[model samples]
Target: MEYLSNWAKNIVYYILFVKLISHLIPSGNMSKYIKLFTGVILIIVVMEPILSLPNMEQKIKSNILNMENIIAHKDFQSQSKTYSKVNDQLAINLYKKQVEEHIRKLVRGEDVEVSSINIKINEEEGKNFGEVVSIDMKVRKKNSSNDLSIEKIKIGADSTAYNITAEDIIIVKNIKIALRGFYNISPDNMNISVSQ
Candidate 1:
């Protein structure tokens, strides 16, 4: 093969060069060092073909690609984990808002208006995840008048006094029942406050 011919030529040239150098130098300690150096070079030249085998380059390239892939895979996994956590938190917040709106709708027909609502949901990873944990709401009577008005008194025994506190308690009870029926929540987990 061409490779074999080239290698043989190289060895022949190296040997002739060494011979010429030895002739120029008298046999001494310097000649001994020169010969030792040329011997090492000759060994390398002889083993060049075996050292540069075709598969060696492919094996090295494959190992480099494997290392790169492992590093990239690790980076991707970490990024995905971070994205997943952010997405989960966003979902929980959105769900809580939706639940609060639903609660307001459920009590819309009642004589009370919802002032504020705070709903808590289970955040753990399980079957109960996203389930409503508790609800806190502030409501006020719908037709309540903020201004005080003076009116003519009808003190004859024919006028009946209306207990406003008793009516407010009834409205609160109705709201509790509606929420409990729809969400399967216990009374203990609900805090419904009526504001004047």
Candidate 2:
């Protein structure tokens, strides 16, 4: 608006002012100097609006701030999602560990060491929950017990089932039974294995 006002006034006075100045000037050697000075002043007046425009530095700074805010917001969302996934996995792992520890605690007589326990879980409708599909373990007897051995006991129709002792598998089956009873899980859906 300021530049527009200045421009309007300049144009309105341009012809009248130039004519008046021309008439008053001593029409001699001095006229050239006066004409030259007036021309220079006219040029300055026309260019003032362009010179007063906003600088590029301020625009660049504003753009940079906007870009920074966008990046920060995106990074925060990505990190939050990653953290949630990790937390869910951690919860599942802790549950599996607790189950293994509980089974280890239940074994009676002749030191029983449980190596590892795994449970398969499933997710549905934005909610996650699953039953133990199968369990595998490495069992070893710490002391020389002459009365009891794992291989002699029978488990199933499969000949390989006997390859791994019955005692170790029976202990695991008991653990599974306890789990099924406690959690109310169907036995048909679960597979239990114990090896020495």
Candidate 3:
């Protein structure tokens, strides 16, 4: 091929030039150093074709861009996963608060004051995720004196007396039943306490 012939001619011309230079210079330490420098130049000339191969620059640039894109994509995926976890946690917290408020309302309907309510739900991802796991509630009966009713005079022996403990048990049972029916939670998972 014409290209191969030109390359061979170039090599021949470089060798002739080096030989002429060496002949003009006397054999000495300086001559060896010059030969070494010329040898390095000869290597560069010999590798010129391969080094200057077509699309080499484009290939290098493309490889760099591909690496950059891969890194960027990995970073984006990591960020998205982090954001998703945070969002899921936020949603879970909001749901817990809403369920607590609903429980408070249900307890209030029984003429009880809710001191605290904690509803635990499944946070893991699965079919049972977000299901209520347990509930802990602390409540107290509302003050009856606020009713402003007149005291009745006892004309005879009382047939029945009010028991606060019994009332509290009834309130707790009612709360458990309400929660079980509405939220499908088991009474075993509920810890309800009525405090004086």
Residue 50 CA error for candidate 2 (Å)? Answer: 5.1
Q: Using lDDT as the measure, which candidate wins?
A: 3
| CA-only RMSD, every prediction | 10.3, 4.8, 9.2
What ranges in model 3 sit over 4 Å off?
Answer: 1-61, 146-164
- For residues 9-68, write the lDDT of model 2, one tens digit per residue: 886677678788888876899888978987887787787666655654577789999999
Candidate 3 has an lDDT of 0.85
Task: At residue 122, give the lDDT of candidate 2.
Answer: 55
| Cα shift from native, residue 22, model 1 (Å) | 11
How much lDDT does candidate 2 score?
A: 0.66
What is candidate 2's TM-score against the reference? 0.61
Runs of candidate 2 exceeding 4 Å displacement: 1-28, 53-56, 106-111, 123-134, 141-169
TM-score of each: 0.61, 0.61, 0.65
2 or 3, which is superior by TM-score? 3
Evaluate candidate 1 by giving its C-alpha RMSD to the native, one decimal: 10.3
Q: Could you tell me which 10 consecutive residues in candidate 1 have the lowest summed lDDT?
A: 148-157
